[model samples]
Target: MPFAHAVMHEENGVFGISFPDFPGCTTGADSEEEAIRKADEVLTFHVAGMLEDGEVLPVRRSLKELLSDPEAKEGLAKGVLFLARYELPRKSVRINISMDETLIEAIDRAAEHANQSRSGFLADAARQRIRDLLKAE
Candidate 1:
């Protein structure tokens, strides 16, 4: 997991988020909670697109370092700062595992309903679980 610094500002009751390290990557919502959630999603997809396009990801900068930059400083002055977690795309590898027969059937049914392969469904479930656990911390 990698975290990006996000600045959230509210205007006319709508919340907007921006990543200084990733210029042009922005998202918004009607509430703070939604803004935070959207920030993570936006950053994750933005980074993935960059990786697909052979663009080098920017270095993660600390709050102190960001403050030294005028643009980031200005954004920080008008908004709240938080870390948005993003996952880097990786090459797929096959693995062998065993699980209860009933559980496997249930997973297959759900995956079919969601129109996703078993691996994709399982990966998404695992990621959501990890995010929930992190939020609990």
Candidate 2:
């Protein structure tokens, strides 16, 4: 299990939560409680997406250090702050999808050449696409 820090900034009745360790990882809600709950799911998805994209996980700063930061401390004054924990999934489930036969063969060959399972190869491709899409925004 790994842990991450989250800071919630309240604005106009909305709670916007963000992770200092992960610059782009964030979620929000109307209440502090909902913001915390959303942070858990966002953290889980973010860590898994990073892993899938073959990106390095960031080393988390201690709570004391996070609290010491100017921006984080500013967030403290503006609203609330907290920590969220996430664990990688212990098991994987098989899935099915329909595709063109030619594409399927190409994907299978690429997976074999990459020394990866078909699922793993496809997962990596999807994650990379997501990264590209986000970066273009």
Candidate 3:
């Protein structure tokens, strides 16, 4: 996983978020909290798309590095900064684990309801939990 600096600007009650390192990658929300949350999703998907297309991911810039750029300076003047987590998807590997039968049954039901394989459902749930934990910090 990598972290990118996300710039957040607000206009007309809507908060807009963008990543300087990843051009054309952006998202927005109705509040600051929502903007932060959406930034994570947008950054992750944007990087994932880039990877899928065989595009090279840029090396993330430090806050100092970003502040040195004139364009970044101007954007910062109008907004604020935060780090958005970027987890690159990798090749899947098979694994085996033991769990309570009832828990496994419930997971299967939830996966079916969501139209996702059990592996996908578990992966998404884990990612969301990681994001929530990171936000709490």
Model 2 TM-score, 2 decimals: 0.64
Kindly give the number of clashing pairs for every candidate.
Answer: 0, 0, 0
lDDT of candidate 2? 0.80
TM-scores, all candidates, are: 0.66, 0.64, 0.65
Give me candidate 3's TM-score against the actual structure: 0.65
By lDDT, the best candidate is 1
Residue 122 error, candidate 1, Å? 20
Model 3 lDDT tens row, 5-101: 8899999998899888888888877889988887887788778768756999999887788889998888888988888897788888888989999
Residue-by-residue lDDT tens digits, candidate 2, 32-87:
88778777877877899788679999998887887788877676676666778877
**lDDT, each prediction:** 0.87, 0.80, 0.84
Better of 1 and 2 by lDDT: 1
Q: Poorest 10 consecutive residues of model 3 by lDDT?
A: 128-137
**Models sorted by TM-score, best on top:** 1, 3, 2
Give RMSD (Å) of candidate 3 vs. truth: 7.1
